[model samples]
Target: MRITTKGQVTIPEEIREAAGFGPGTEVDFVIGDDGLVRVIPSDRLRGERAASLQGAISRLRGSADVALPTDEIMALTRE
Candidate 1:
């Protein structure tokens, strides 16, 4: 199938059905390490976002040196 000037290509009905891509389904395009592109549905997007957030939390887990309480932190921020 040809992509239009808008970079849009229609996926075949059979493939769409197999992939559970019904009308109005939210999708994301992912490029793999093997240089292959994949169409991922939104249901999987939540897991991906959670994993990314977990990674960030892990990286910042012990980076905070200050032990200020919530009110003190808020006061510092206001100053």
Candidate 2:
């Protein structure tokens, strides 16, 4: 996939599913010694259990109080 005119690129669905990436998911890029960049789920990196991917997704659902509307969330992904 190509980056848009705004330098935005869509993550593949399978990668998103595998990485527990949903709207509002916080991610950081990890450049390894292998010269590959990995998109890491910030929650897991922050000491949240690696098996608790759903927990991160659920938090984005407003369980903790600050849920954004779908359009607003999608707009962020484009940026």
Candidate 3:
């Protein structure tokens, strides 16, 4: 398994299947604290980020209790 001139190495079919990597799959390379590199699906990271964003949004929900309508807010801003 040699890296191409473009620094691209093909993952073996077995590894790809085991890792659930299909064609057009987006992957991320992570270096562990133990000095091991791993390839992970980008959606996995997105899922974590989505969860974090959901939590943040949930916390902020209802925090903005505005009584003004859109037009009124726009008018105030314009003024």
Candidate 1, residues 8-78: lDDT per residue as tens digits?
99999999999999999999999999999999997798898999999999999999898999999999999
What lDDT score goes with residue 78 in model 3? 98
The lDDT leader among the candidates is 1
Model 1 clash tally, residue pairs: 0
Ranking by TM-score: 1, 3, 2
**CA lDDT, every prediction?**
0.95, 0.81, 0.94
User: Model 3, 58: alpha-carbon shift in Å?
Assistant: 6.4
Task: For model 2, state the Cα shift of residue 36 in Å.
Answer: 0.4
Per-prediction TM-score, please? 0.69, 0.50, 0.62
Best by TM-score: 1
Q: Which stretches of candidate 3 lie over 4 Å from their true place?
A: 53-79
lDDT of 3 at 15: 99
